[model samples]
Target: MTYLNTRGSRVSIRMSKESDLTVLVIGSGGREHSLVKICLNSPIVSKVIAAPGNGGIATEAECHPVQVDDPADIVSLAQRVEASLVIVGPEVPLAAGAVDALEAVGILAYGPGKAAAQLEASKAFCKDFFARHGIPTAAYGTFSDVDSALAYLDTQSYPLVIKASGLAAGKGVIIAENREEAASTVQEMLSGAAFGDSGRQVVIEEFLEGEEASIHIMVSGEDYLMLPPSQDHKRIGEGDTGLNTGGMGAYAPASIITPELEQEIRDTVIRTTIDGLMKDKLDYRGTLYIGLMLTDAGPKVLEFNVRFGDPETQVILPLVADDLVDIFLKCARGDALPDKLNLHPAYSMVVVLVASGYPGSYPKGDPISLPDQLMRSATLVHAGTKINPEGELVTNGGRVLGVIGTGPTLKISAEKAYALVDQVIFSTKVFRKDIGWRQLERKPHKA
Candidate 1:
């Protein structure tokens, strides 16, 4: 596909094996590893490179061994290698406007631009956006002062969720179910006792009922492509109890939205969201992630991730049938491609193994013993580990790896997930047992 600029110059991509284009994958985690794995599988890819990749990702691509957040270095590397397409995985770069910077140098990048990124960076902005766009989300009211928030909370029901407006590395949210609990939570935010400056302003939203689900859509301006629905287990313990970590596990396609139901969401929320951004003069390009809650009435948008969600990305990428490069370019050019994108007919589940005491502080540097032939048996995408000078693998961060299992039936996939979980050995390893408990009961129709 060729896209022309305003000056009548043609913008073309190199998608063949003999292509001159190089691939630069930003961010180092299981999510980025999943992307790098997908890109490496592409016959169209010539060279795959990662900036400061982890120990697990180093095996997949040529590791650049530089800081992931250094935008100047990122741009310099792009220019040095003449990268054809740059894919960003984490939210920090997107919030930092790496796409805007890369594009300023004529590099095509996947992910939304900076102006479109405030939807994820600021919860207050997103709540207002939901109200303005009629996006069908949980009831929310924003506040800068704790007194106003506390005053508003007393009039409302128990069990409300308070969120920090800025990035808190997934630990910015607090769910308080009682008067005392809510008061303490407000004090924590207002006094800067938690989440630091991220808590300067808080978004207190009505605690939503019903199950949680994740929906990722590829957007080319107003045109959108929806992936198979997946449900992620956020809480650390079984039966969905315990403090919320990043994500324990995920599985798809969720039985929540059938074809008839999905089409309704596309018409209402998904399409309307992209159209709203454009109407509001926000040029939202690339992927738009809508984390939703399937309630009694219908689906309600829980949060908007301008980029892909971590554990969610681990499972969704395996099911996609279209060439990732092909879809990305199509979206970047703002052209509507085929609506009938294919996915694997089977179900896939990803169980994330985390260190003990996560969503707080956890121990690191634990050795991991993983079996070979992951892609053939279960896909292993590393999140936090580094290779030492002695070539020994050591834990570098929490949320270690996504052990994925794929099969025709959800039961078989779950079985495979647990089976693979048994093979890996790590001290203080923890994962939720029942990842796909809800949707597996209902017979799936269409994602």
Candidate 2:
């Protein structure tokens, strides 16, 4: 697919140029910014473009002015540039069938189809998928009527997981500590006014006590390839206190899974999901993130995402040594992965810097200070940020930059992450101090 170059020079292109691959990444967040950086570093990738990107992204990729939520603009951008790949970084585009749209026009997209993305769009669909695939997960029931949900809650346990059935942008989930709290959660979700259409229905599940881990697996049709495991802190305050935001911080190489358990996870959860997608004839591309609860009984599925995780991506992408653009192109074409996709075996930690009164409403337009080039050793991935017409960088979303650090060990990574974060300044910036404490014992779940 050759398009006239900006200068009207003849450039041979095959769908997208594998060498100097012109890639268009969708979404305006730290994850997409991290993706842009990784792709730009690829020896084969020549250019990186982001649609409706944040301030940090503009520094790395040519920022294209298109709304992330509008799939038509995204597809048109890719078609116009003859981009080789369209990598989606958020759930909204996946649910909007952006992948289907891009592929329909001869452009390869790295996102799940609408059928597969339903796993992320609807919690109720995730539960149904788990049940249908025979994948182990916490028992749950869905409800659309308010009274039925209230009545069903009478027999359930405390410390329940309450989730809005439709997309809620990570804020739809609530972990209630008591029966009273659980009931209140049910009431709020079914009330149909709290989360808008997202709360039209809800899923209430028995809480499983376990350490949580985030795992992303690249799927090419029936083939499944797993990435290094990562863990994200979703709570807002230190020690995981306060309300749940999108994500507070994250770290990779969590000792939660031993080599033996890692294989078990693949055989049970990851493999089963791929098989299910194949059986249903659903074409899956890009990455599928499975949020797991390693319980005493076993590893249980918590949630699914059609794209790479946010803070998790901040840590995971830095550890990868392979040319990401090449891998993405291969996956798009249904080519088998190399036997080994090399990843640096280092402890990568990411901390999300949020504004004051965030996850509610906070101040914007504050000029965030970026460290000088020498002091800016850490990668500050832009999430919620935008440039004012006056050229001042300001906050645009609740979660801001993803402060990422890679080191010899988790402790070293943590130190580097916080040190870099300290050099930067934002008004009422809040972050969690206990980022990797959960894995401090080196004790795996007793399953």
Candidate 3:
């Protein structure tokens, strides 16, 4: 397949090893690893490269050392590698206009530009946009100083949520249990004592109650593809008891979101958001992650992520039946997307293993041991691991790895994932035992 360039030159679409369709994935986390894996599975993808990839990713794709923060470095690397499709995985680069930089050089990039990334980069902006569009979200009040936020907190009820307006790597939101905690949290955020510059401004919102489901979508000028819904366990401890972490574990095809509930989300939240973006003239492209709270009233927006979720991606990608490289290429090229995504009728689960005392301070450089082959239904996706001097895989960050399992049933998937989790050995490796607890409580879907 080929298309005519703007300058009237012929540009052939790279479809396989015969073509020069080199894909460059930007990030060094589990999400990027999943993207690399999905792309490699595509028959149309000739080659895939990851920038600053981790140890496990090194085995799958060619790992190149490049700074994700610097748009110039990312663009230069993509150009040097002659990447046909550049998928920006992390939010920082997209917020920094890396996609714009790639498009500026005539490269097809997947992700929103800087202007559209405010949906995730700035919480205050997202709230304001939600209000303007009448999208269903928790009522929010933005404050730039401590005094005003304190006054606002006094008027609000207990069990409120306060958020740092800027990105803080997913640790910026605080659910205050009472007035005292809310006041202290407000001061901590506004004074920049908690998250530095990212906490200069804060958004205090109503505490919503209900199940949270993540909706991943690919959009191009209003054309959209909705992937299967997934739920993530965010807290560190079991039964949702500990401080929040990036995400502990996740499962796809969340049965809690019934067919009716999914349509409600599509009609009220997803459609409204896309229409609002078009009305605002954002020219939004790439993934729009809708973090939704399925309240009794309806599905409400909890937050938005410009890129794919980490543990969620690890589970969701396995359910996708289409060629990932082909989908990304079509989306990046501004082609019409399939009305509905093809999802396998199976449950996929990912259990994240973290080092001890994670979401705070934890130890690194510990040796890691893994079996030669996992169980038939399991896959080990690396996140925060690197090759040591002795060429051994060692723990390099808080979240160590994600073990993904797929099976005909959710129970089987969880069993497979936990079985693989036991195979990974690290000195302080920690993980949750109950990943799909809620899903398990619900009856399995009848075929």
Number of the top candidate by TM-score?
3
Candidate 3 regions off by >4 Å? 1-19, 443-447
TM-score of each: 0.92, 0.92, 0.95
lDDT of 3 by residue, 317-385 (tens): 899988777777766766677777888889999999999999899999999999997778899999999
lDDT of 2 by residue, 1-447 (tens): 544322232323454334757788888888889889988898887778888788988877788787667778888888877787788889998898887778767676777877888989988988998899999999999999978888888888788889899998787888888878888878877887779889989999988888889798887776666788988888888787878888999888777777888989988998888888877777677799999999988899988888898889888888888877777776676666676668886888888999888889988888887877624336788898888888878888788788887787887788888899888787768777788777654555321
Q: Considering only N, C-alpha and C atoms within 3 Å, which residue pairs clash in candidate 3?
A: none
For candidate 2, what's the RMSD?
Answer: 4.7
Task: Rank candidates, TM-score, best first.
Answer: 3, 1, 2
TM-score comparison, 1 vs 2, better candidate: 1
Query: Which scores better on TM-score, 1 or 3?
Result: 3
Higher-lDDT candidate among 1 and 2? 2
Once model 1 is optimally superposed onto the true structure by TM-score, how far is the C-alpha of residue 358 displaced, in angstroms?
Answer: 2.6
Global CA lDDT computed for model 2: 0.81
Query: Worst 10-residue stretch by lDDT in candidate 3?
Result: 5-14
Q: What is the C-alpha lDDT of each candidate?
A: 0.80, 0.81, 0.88
